[model samples]
Target: MARLDIKRKRVALTRELARLKHDLQARELDLEIQCRAMQDTLGELEESRSRYAELYDYAPVGYLTFDAKGCITEINLTGAAVLGMERTRLIGMPMSVFIDKGSCQLFFTHLRSCRLTGKKVTTEVKLAPKNAAPIHAQIISMPLPGGKGYGSQYRSIIADITERRHMEQEMLRMDRLNLIGEMAAGIAHEIRNPMTTVRGFLQTFMRRQEFAHIQSQLDLMLTELDRANAIITEYLSLARNKPVDQSLQSLNKIVADLLPLMESDALLHAKWVVAELPDSLPELRLDAQEIRQLLLNLVRNGLEAMAPGGRITLRTAVEDNQVVLFIQDQGPGIPAEVLPKLGTPFVTTKEDGTGLGLPICYSIAQRHHAQIEIETGNCGTTFIVKFPYPK
Candidate 1:
């Protein structure tokens, strides 16, 4: 009986040991599965971090972080590019160093407002980068929480508004041009009819032998009348509502056809005309006559701006899906004060200029959906007419 009882206890102990071993194996498998899931989650987190970094670095506008002391603590790649410096070098630099001399006070005031109010503040200032042209920047800044022993930090976003400002000015100029055009359209025909009658009577009188002694005098009056009529014709051209006959035409061909006339004008002025036209270019929807007139006006202006020995270059290029006509002259630059009023009627840099030429050019460009941009410096001035490709 004692031997049987000892055998039963041994069997029961073996069964209990086997059950514990099975439970331990199940727990090990569960831990292994969880470890794999954790590894996958870590990989996803790292990928998300990389994606965010790319978005921050390559944003269109600039991003900057300023510390409490008004120094740059962090800057993105775009900000570095805008400042014309490397990101590493811009760190910890005073932002005032990059601000235009005239805008430093304004910047300080903007900074102070954000810090004092601990709220959003905005300001427009000119950024004078060492290697790039001055940028018209609009900054929107907001205060951030500061750490222990530090004042309020700030986050700044900088946007380039140069193009927007230019567009506003252009719109304003267009309004002025339209006003002049309306006035010209109303009065041009009325003025030309009476002048025509006066010219006809003057010509008839010149033919009479009795008035032969005063023939020279009558001729001068006739000449003056003709000049007045020519001026009126230009005024009619300035009418912005004038219809344009646009067709698919080769700009290069038009330019080639006008080379002879342009050369003659240059020669008359004892100047040189050089053509740098491309062999081929995209066809533009344009009015042939108006394009010719536009080219002639720009070329004439270039020639007049230059000295006798100077050269005017007519260049045609394709840029950014647009055809660009460049009339460059080797002349002293246009006056700074006169640049803003360039397209206005009767505003001319030349003493004898009617100031009607450029206004007419502007009017034609608008009718053809083109833009005229001027680039002038001490070296010379270039008139750029950009014509967009057909939609």
Candidate 2:
């Protein structure tokens, strides 16, 4: 009986030990699985870091990082190249230094907004190249998060968009000029028959000298016909297919010559004409006829801007190797909305005006490689003509 009891106790002990061993082995397996999961997580983190680095280094657009104080901290190779500076040199330098001096004020205002508010900003600006010539840039900036205790920093993506912008402008200009040419050609052909009929009738009627009482009327009609012919001539001039006849022409001489003629029409309105120009200035390579006609159109527009007893000033100056001409009038300044599209054909602020004057002026300026700018306010409007030096 004692042996039987002892055997039963031994069997029970063996089963209990086997169960404990199984539980221990299961725990070991679980531990190994957890360890593998941890290894995978670490490997994934490393791969993500590599991918971010690759993107940062290989971005096509120039990337840059700057502190709130405008000092550059890090710049990609592309950024350095765009700025025409070494990465080491760019670092610690104020990013604003790269902005063209003429536009720095505007650029800084936009920049300050992004830095202080942690907002995103974009601008199209001109950057001064190594040779001091300007190159266009499309820049995007944003506030980036940084390490704890580190203040927010700015990151920029910049692209050299000079050629792209130039091409776009050229294409638009060509389209506009083409449309003007088609219109002018069509109108010239249409007016030719009427002009011939008027000329023949005037000649035949004038030979009847016995119609002395009607001579004055006949002369007036002849004058009107001549004016009509002049208008046609100008319309045809707009479609000039020949290259611009570039010659050094004095802008002051042109303006001076046109003053008497411009004020003649305005005499009925009793407006005062003002001329502010120096004795002489350098000449520009220009088409004398085109420029004179443009000036006439602009001055006539100025004259029509005012009521009786208003003032008009035509001013000229030499600025930085460019001919600066201003036609200002104390009349109803152009509306802000219309200022941008003032050069578009058939767009006019005046009820009776054809709106072709400015478009023609713009085309002639383009041929001369000149820029036309308009500044209008409650006080007055000024049309500024800036002619570039011939290349």
Candidate 3:
């Protein structure tokens, strides 16, 4: 009886140990599943962070974070690119260093507005990046709450507006040209008729012996009349409806025909003229007289700008499927203020200039469906005329 009772007790103990071992195995399986899930969740989070970082770095517009003291706390890749510097190098640099000297005050005012109002602020400022031309930028900034014991911060977005500003100025200039065109159309013929009559009578009197005593005076009067007539001709040229006779012709031939005259003028002015015409250029549909006038005006302007011994280089090439003519001069660059108003009527830098020369040049270019561009620096100035290929 004692042996049977001991066997029963051992069987019950074995059953309980088996049940405990099964329960422990189930818990281990659940723990392993939970560990895998946690690992997957961490990986997803890391991936999301990486995507966010990429977006921040490669955004089109610049993003910048400035401390309360206006020092750069953070800058993205685009921001660094706009500043013409590296992101790591831009950190902790003063934001004003990249701003135009003229716009430093404006930048500070923008920062003050953001801080004082604790709201979004907007400003247009010029950025002077190193080794690059100045660019116009519109900056929109929002005040940010302090974090990690840091003082107040500001978040900013910068958009390059240089091209937009240039377009606006060009539109304004075109509007002025249109106005001048209207005025010229209205008054040019009316004024020229009387001037022609007066010039004719003066010429008649100059040939008379009765007016021989005042011959020099008559010559002066005739010369003045001729000047007035020439000015009227320029005004007529500015008329938008002026006719142009387009013909398929070689640009090199035109330059060759004008070379002797250009050289004569250069010799008179104690300057030199150099022509670089290519032999294998495509024929362009052009108004020969208009092109000749354009070339002469540009060459004369270059000659006038230069001092004695200065050389003007004339070059023609085929670029980007367009015929390009370059009139380059080694003269003092145009004034910054005068650059934007180059094609506007009555805007002149010379003492005796009528200011109509460039306007007429612009008008001729427009009539020919060509574009005239000016590149001026401290060293010199170049007038580039581009004509599209004939279709």
> Best candidate per TM-score, number?
1
Please provide, for model 1 over 1-391, each residue's C-alpha lDDT reduced to its tens digit, 9 standing for 90 to 100: 9999999999998998898888888989988899999999999999999998888999998999998777999999998998889999999999999999999999989888987777899999999876999988999898887674224678999888889888888888777878877887889878888988998999899989999999999999998888888887787787778878999999989988999988998898799998998888999899999999989988888888888988988899999988999989999989989998888889987788899899899989999889999999998999999998998
The lDDT, on a scale of 0 to 1, for candidate 2 is: 0.80
Which regions in candidate 3 have their CA more than 4 angstroms from the true location? 1-48, 116-118, 130-133, 145-151, 307-309, 332-341, 376-380
lDDT of 2 by residue, 115-140 (tens): 66677889888887554567899888
In candidate 3, clashing pairs total 0
Which model, 1 or 2, shows the larger TM-score?
1
lDDT of model 3 at position 266: 99
Which 10-residue window in model 2 sums to the lowest lDDT?
A: 234-243
Query: Which candidate wins on lDDT?
Result: 3
lDDT of 3 by residue, 319-355 (tens): 9999999999999999999898899889988899999
RMSD of each: 3.5, 16.7, 3.9
Model 1 spans with C-alpha error above 4 angstroms: 1-10, 116-118, 146-151, 193-228, 276-283, 317-321, 333-341, 374-380
Name the lDDT of candidate 1: 0.88
What would the C-alpha RMSD of candidate 3 be, to one decimal place?
3.9
TM-score of each predicted structure versus truth: 0.84, 0.54, 0.81
